[model samples]
Target: MLKPYQVYNTHSLSLCYNDYLLLQLLLCFWSSLFSLCLSLARNTKKILYLLQVAHKNSSMAKSICFCLQKLVFFILLSAIVSHARPPQVLPRQEPSYLKFVFNATDLPSEDYYDYIVVGGGTAGCPLAASLSHTFRVLLLERGGIAYGKANLMTQDGFLSTLVEVNAFDSPAQAFTSEDGVPNARGRVLGGSSAINAGFYSRADMDFYKNSGINWDLKLVNESYDWVERAIVFRPELKNWQSAVRDGLLEAGVDPYNGFSLDHIPGTKIGGSTFDSFGRRHSAADLLLYARAANIRVGVYASVERVLLASTTPFSGSRQSAIGVVFRDSNGRYHHAMVRRHGEVILSAGAIGSPQLLLLSGVGPRPQLSAWGIPVARHSPYVGQFLYDNPRNGISIVPSIPLEHSLIQVVGITEDGAYIEAASNIIPFASPARSVFIHTPSSPLYLTVATLMEKIVGPVSSGSLRLGSLDVRVNPIIRFNYFNNPVDVRRCVNGTRKLAGVLRSRSMEDFKFRDWFGNRDFRFVGPALPVNQTDEDQMADFCRRTVSTIWHYHGGCVVGKVVDGDFMVMGMNGLRVVDGSVFGVSPGTNPQATLMMMGRYVGMKIIRDRLRYS
Candidate 1:
């Protein structure tokens, strides 16, 4: 955790650059106004004599005062214009839909809901919204309300939100794995969607096939349309995004697959959650689809564990889940139950969902006993087989100012690796330097070009273990990235491919210049050392320098911890939805796929509830 001063210092550089420009310019007028006031004093005697003579005649006095006031107003206006600061776009204001939202402290009298959806995030928000149409639903989130922090989310501050020191107060909760990989998860109602780059793309066809579940492709397409209408947009490709697309084609990614959501081979442009005006539309926005009367959302409500009945409804199965125990903002605990034939759904993300199950005594018997948690069922795979789409990349500091753009083009390798590039377009001007130099020229924009790769589903595996029985304590996470030899080779090839693309003749127009005036440009991550040709060395470099692209799945996989319908293997009336149920990584940013899973699960539960009733 960073201290207050450290936090301030970390943000001060960018904050001052973005916010203090006007303040510095206004300060210059202080001295100028003092001299102007002295000059006005010399004319005071003459003005008073004119005023006294005019007072003898009322109309002349009124005319003279009006003229003097107008002249003074124009003079101030001119002075302000002359010292005006350079143009900078202001961050967007928060959305106005917060009036209908509620905090956990003010829950309704009804303790029973037709469906209890834990975690009001990317998956949970849409699932609750979808289920609300048919049954009364309860949605709970552990984070504070995100309604009033629009500027922090919608603007370029998305990156800052991830590194926020106050973990509980921030929308993003940062954590480091046992292997020392730094990662973060969204803690707000929108979940990770509130803090991500907003790139929207569906999973590849292989992802669905490998899941071993029968999905109606037509219904899946309909669900995609349902989400698209609310938040997805075709991003207008800027200069940087355009150059990346051309470069990928030049590197033989082949056949430009223009403007589509489907994960096709070759280079293609995808959708984004951010609109044309640069305002972010999070998954929480999809709550608009919910039936307001039947839906109740409670933010800052942390779920402790799933409550189970003393006996199972079935003759020989795990105990039936009845409700949940949660803590509110005031540190008050509450038990929220479900109506008869209703269900409890856990959409608390990859980490939270699995941890909840383990806390509820539904994990491996040996591990639960080791943690002193009473065992209700002996499901061995509650938090096993975790996968993080590890990404190895290169970043170049270009000499030319790059236009702002998120990921637009993606290259799908035959070996099942995904590659893409992105850059920040927000312009900046150094206020401190401008004040000292007395010049208002354009500041150098830090343009970053990255070539990132994600292995769709790798042979390597990791696990999440309980640090303690306490719900407040986070679980131990380890990605064990690149443990498989196959994964190592795929990353090596992908990294080389990205380097080739950058050196391609198509990228010749833009000079890849470093921020420092050196002929040698900067290469981010593990650079291919000069004349280093050993595959073993390249593999080692990747292992030490790899980072997650934030697409983590499994841990509570469908076939392992849950069934084909996403129901807990041993427990009745309990299901896990969210990325934790993903049998494999989606091969791209998993936001689109996660939302689709929420929609699918919501619809499935609705159908099952109606059939049973």
Candidate 2:
């Protein structure tokens, strides 16, 4: 009934009216919501203020009663947020050689491999990658990848990972020796190298000579270069570290070797596995050298046993290793067969390698029979000759604070001791502290300067025996540290020598003093008793306090268990390239040496079997 212009105007007015109504409704809703929020916030502030005032003014019981409701609310809120949120989904760049197996279903259907390397650790990762250059290698790791572990990346997180009970099932498996020495090993891909203090130094040349194996020293040097280029970096010495270096130099550890990876007998700054930005570069990075198509890395694949075939080409009488049986993350067991002319190498570290060997019925015949396990080989020395590098240290709280540092300045002693110093920047909470109280207005901090002294080439030795048949359980280790008179003397001497370093002008500048449970007091080990003949007290301290730096070696000695080429003497197609095959401990942090051993053995296999067999 209306004209065209009137009709258009009417429609436009209706649309505008509807839009205006909607806008007004939204504004009203927002205004009410904002006011409610403001009221709630003010109430919250008042409640917090009341709680604080009551806590300060009232008795302890009254304060707790008043704050219980607020605490309960916050706890509930935190629980809701945590459980309501989805799990963190990590981004992936499709790996060529690496396959993260969450369960048995994730593994490939094929069961054959050219080489099976057990334990994707420092030695195993590089060894598998190197062998895969010419063979279809399978690297099985029991633990997950370390790329996104927040606990491993932070500064004080190392301590948290070490001390926290919740972290027992973490990649770093913590254990205590029968002697009550607390130690840990990496269940992760990088092994102990990933969890260690990160120092990277080649063994002293004497280590090679003492090893009794005909090591191609030239090739050893090349392997060192190969590893160092990938992971080693010269650490920047901080205030406390530099002061310790000066103290070492002043204490007659002469011939200052500046920023070198060579294991020299003097004050020197060594390389760390962490890069300049403090990011750790583990041996897992060495897998980059492999041709992706030739390698298959399965994380959380726990190798249970090495499969042996009756026919042996190398040794007519003995059985040959042709495959391995492992359990995936889902607890499903799978078998992997070795190809023709292929081998099974055990790079599962000192304790793990021997344990696996024993589990596979390749250890001492008597022990195997006692355990009711079928003996595959009568290798008597499979778990013998186990030794650990023992460390004794003194902790001091200086009048002035100390900077955080790892192993930096070391004083190699004539009496077979490697003395080093470390400090933590955070407040040194004593073990007795029931609670660490921190306030926003005045933050409390403490610094602990620890002088650690390790005995080089310790005479004390022990054994690693199978605790059970389960691969999940850790082996029982009995490291008889300070058992030998010579070892006790060296540890005592080492502590005394480090005490002298603390007495130097550089260390005295900070007024270094001992830390009681709660208070800091002046008590130096050397100055204790403040008189002559404190040797007895010092010796007692060494005996009671000596623990392992976790540099465990031997069990599968090169000459006794495996031959010079790292092959098992009585078996074929089975070799060990881990710290277990060491003829002797390299008398330093054994990470670099263990890596070199892996490389050397891989190269040997390439030359002896892959190329010329």
Candidate 3:
């Protein structure tokens, strides 16, 4: 132990000396290393923070770009799709007469045919064909064609469904009257000819003889063959075995002899044949043939009004037809001057023809005044003497089955005076519906029909007038359907007798229902729904419940309102051709009569008037 201060100084000096150059260098290096480490750690932390900021900015930029792209795509897609659509528009509700299956192309103003016939209906169909060969004819129809629609083309729709009636398929929102039935006209090209069941027969000859017209059975009989060939009328079944027929036979009813088997009477008896369309053909087929033969047709052009010639060409009467004013589907108005002095035949048919005449000032003056229509002339018989098939009907559940439900049976009055008796029977069957696929073989249901030819038919002729230039107003029809005592007696007896058949032990196998199926009249015609104690009570029911079977006729009777040859009597160049020519109801199905009228008038026009003119 040296002195304390001296020893410390010595120890310091010795330590300094003992620390070598390498050690000194190492210490310096270690101090630098620590400072460098601290700097690196701070720099690394700053670099990491900078990288995190870059990542956040980049992600935000990408999200902004994505949103902008989506907005652009949405705007472009919406604009493109909005520009695509079809050119033509179709009608929402079709016309009632569309069942007639008529179609036509746009008629050019360049078309200048000699004879222009209005309407393409039952009578008009054959008439068009007959005259087309000799003349340049133009047939104008107010409705579209039913070519592509299956229900009309193949007759797939049911015959008995109320769809066949004149009412709109949609129910009315507000009714205008107590008996607000929607009476209507056929709207398709062929008018009512397309959907009819083709029942064939003529009315009482007495009706024609008694009417002031110069008509007789001799003239009618002579023209029968010519008409049959055009229409092709023949019974689907020759020797029948239907229950209704059998029932009538059991009651001693004879085949309708007014003409004797109006359908295809055996050659030994008359020696003629016919086909499905009453006799041999349908109006649609006939008109199509005419079209193929190069006859021009125009459809969906409703004639707005007749544009008469400003100058007169007749004796105290202006030119019969100067030109016709009409309209197109676009609601644009148009006109067609009769082809260079060519005459127009007004076959607008029934309601249309009379309406046209009245609107043009050629009908009953007083009635026109009451309806607020300006009267052109005071022709008294314009809408007079309307007639239609007086349909007599009753339902029965048949005990027997028959092939081909349409026209499965027929019977006729045995005596000249059928007023005291109810004889003959015809039956129609409803189509097979439901998954059950029931056949006529089942004999489960049947409906029998009979017609009263002579009765108190339509008393007041209905008038079709325009409320405005374009709107068709409701027609005024006052028909006392079964007003005659004879009609009442016939129904009561028929119903009572038919009721007996259903009740008969023979018909025990069949089921029956009527009056909405409330009272079961099993077999025999249930006694008339009306109290049968007297005829007046029954007649009242007949008038109330009976709606038209849609066989309207005679409102525009040819001889009286027009002429014996169906020429508009007062006017020069127009004519009427349709069921409306009948003075009273035809005794049988109106199909044959209509065809005959068409054929007869067509031939007459071609032979006499055209040849002479």
List of clashing residue pairs for candidate 1: 404-425
Q: How well is each residue in 31-97 modelled by candidate 1, as lDDT tens digits?
A: 4554556666888997788888997988888777666554553344333233333223344444433
Q: Rank the candidates by TM-score, best first.
A: 1, 2, 3
Clashes of each: 1, 0, 27
For candidate 2, write residues 125-190 as lDDT tens digits.
Answer: 888877877889888888776655544543334554455423424777877888888888788778
- Of the two candidates 2 and 3, the one with more favorable TM-score, higher being better, is 2
Q: For candidate 2, which ten residues in a row score worst on lDDT? A: 6-15
Please report, in order, the local distance difference test score of every candidate based on alpha carbons: 0.74, 0.72, 0.48
**lDDT (10s digit) by residue, model 3, range 1-613:** 1111100111010001112332353344335545645665778876567556758797755554454343433233222212221112121233222222222324554446667777766777677767787777767767655444333432212132214333222111111212333344566555665554444455555556654456545646655665555444334343222334444445545443332435321111111122433221346456644534436556666775665553553456434665676666666665666665566666666667777777776677777787677765677877666553234444432322322223333343422212111211211222253122256332112222222222323343443433444423434553344445565555555444444333444334333322233334322232355445565665554554444556667767756777776766766677778766666655445656676666666667676756777
In Å, residue 467's CA in model 1 sits off its true spot by 1.3
What local lDDT score does residue 352 receive in model 2, on the 0 to 100 scale?
91
Candidates 1 and 3 compared: the better one by lDDT is: 1
Candidate 1 accuracy as TM-score: 0.82
